[model samples]
Target: MHNISKNNEKPEYGWFVKDLIVAFSIIGFIGIIFVSLGIFLTDLLQLFFIFAGIFIIVLFLWPGLGMAVMNIILDWKDDDITDSFDEMKRLEIPIILDIGCGTGRTAMKIVKALENGGHLYGIDIYNKMAISGNDLERVRKNAQLEGVAEKTTFQYGTATEIPFEDESFDIVNVSSVLHEIHDREDQKKAIKEIYRVLKPSGTVYIGEWNSRSAQLIGYMGIFCFVFKPSKYWEYLLKESNLTLMNVEEKGGFVLFTAQK
Candidate 1:
């Protein structure tokens, strides 16, 4: 007769080592409280035990959990490349424009990624935020450090009136900047300018507000009901000359990429 072994017991340690350390720390804390109240411990021993336990717990917990969080923060700080650029690279290294390029994250990222010769231009409406808040100088410094500063240029300009001839850029990307403007007419005009300046078959990308949390959704619902339908942006893009390529709704932001 063959006997079956029960493997049902949760292995006390594997994936959640940090959680285990935290749990142990909590238990140790409670135990320390009992010892202090009941046993009448001396001040030195009490302090030593409490500190040592806390230190040990943090030591065990920090590596995995802390490293994961650090990696996420670093990724957020770095430039992101969407898969749509694959075709852009395959065809030619086209001149790229970043509208509302606060601190030049996307602009820097694209410039660094390009091979051979390609020009990059960035424009921002807010002078202070574009230069100071976005760490534009840092981007410039990095570009110079990487020997690509000559290929990049930045200007203070509004998206509605881009200082360029028609059909100027091969690709334009605007990230996380629409809802803040709050002027529908100006927003439409800005988009039209983007379309006008983009060469035929060029790509335009827009990332904008896609959600309001449950707490804020009530306000959004009321505003939508009174003024416009839900997903007004989706319809706006439909009416534009560009063809929508993708809509990614994640991390409380929507990424919309289109081709002219």
Candidate 2:
């Protein structure tokens, strides 16, 4: 097993931290400007400016800081993925596929949880904007550092056109990926591909953000509009002919477990 010494090295989750810092800086600058303007104004107008400045800062910073806490400090994604794995029935020598396996974050965790002998194949288009240094080589290196390289494989692939035979995977995992497909038609095609690649009675786990939830509104603010509601995913699963087995929600995220 390939392993990296745990001296000072750590997994890089991406530019989220840097992005949050930038956002905070901008918010602070704008807030300062508004407060400065209020000092020169008169009566109710001054009060309005001061309050509006504080409100704007709080409004956006609440979500931005919350995201930092959940993603960076708490590493909630790992916990959520592990919870999904715990729900699955044990399969001997399972053949697993991780869609949109960015930087091997989710894929490595899944492989580590496999007590039985099995291999995990991860595929991603490696969209750089999705995550800092998101590429096949980075994922492979991460697997090696995590000491799961021998049981894991990373490659370039898309959800709409999975480069594998029908019924190839015993289990499929999609985490916060389908929403990136954007177009509803392409999203449906991706679901169909997932269904096609699963063996009979195979299980699929899909994790997505619920746009309609209060958690999302609190954490993402107006940006939550980017995600679809949980009902949309249920409809997609039904449309793809996959039987929805269970739906789990936590921290504004939803996990849909289905069977093929």
Candidate 3:
């Protein structure tokens, strides 16, 4: 694992605490709506509000269920997300950059894979999501706990305008982040930015949620399904100068590889 920065800072778990607060606020708001209108209606709206509050509580209490369902609908794999890259075993030491690397799940894998050592940089635009939902700080703490503290750097930034220099990285990986962007132009800009920061012939790995029927409905599904089929891996090559390498389609994800 490339500890891209030298700060040796502990991973932060403060984001989860914020999630708790937001969850409570959602429940409270729903309660107020229900109480203010329950007596005027046939109880349909009241029941709906009550159910919404219950679901929010469930999300707070058992976030794993929500997160798992998210993975399933988004076709995001909890295990083996980067298993295809195992073949890179014999290559020279490669600098790996992970975009929107939530909680550092795949980042940890890259750390263990590169013994000769390289750089690991993670960027996320939403600090609350990165802190609470992803616990990226905790991931930094784990790296430190495991003595790889010298190899990782985490930053707060956006994908469309990565703060790194051009042609700096040997490999760049993005997992389960495209859909959340919700803008075709921005998504394209981000992809181009990834290519810009990569060295010539450098590899770019992208794993994203495939279109699943269940994902087309529900709130969580709506969240992940915002990015359509075209703006993803398939048309990226057509829109840019990168060379397509391979694509792996799993139940809910499409893992795409390309070279710049």
Query: How do the residues 109-199 of candidate 1 rate in per-residue lDDT, one tens digit apiece?
Result: 6776677768888877654422333444544554565456799987777788989999989888887566556688887898899899999
Per-residue lDDT of candidate 3, residues 1-260 (tens digit): 23334665543323323454456455545555654565455667867766665554444433433444544443333365656875344456777788987667677777677767677888777545434555555666766755666788877778899989999888888876776676778888988999999988788888875655343333233333444563355886667778888888765557888889
As a TM-score, model 1 comes out at 0.60
Question: When superposed on Cα atoms, how far off is each prediction in RMSD?
Answer: 15.7, 3.1, 6.4
Lowest lDDT sum, 10 consecutive residues, model 3, at: 215-224
**Per-model CA lDDT versus the true structure:** 0.61, 0.81, 0.65
Worst 10 residues of 2 by lDDT: 71-80
Those runs of model 2 whose alpha carbons end farther than 4 Å from true positions after fitting are 1-8, 15-28, 43-62, 76-80, 86-89
Query: lDDT by residue for model 2 over 76-160, one digit each (tens)?
Result: 4346366566534378788999999988777887888888779999999988767777878788778777878899988889999
**TM-score of model 2 relative to the true fold?**
0.86
Q: Pick the candidate with the highest lDDT.
A: 2
Where in model 3 is the C-alpha error above 4 Å?
1-78, 86-88, 130-136, 213-224
Q: What is the lDDT of residue 91 in candidate 2?
A: 86
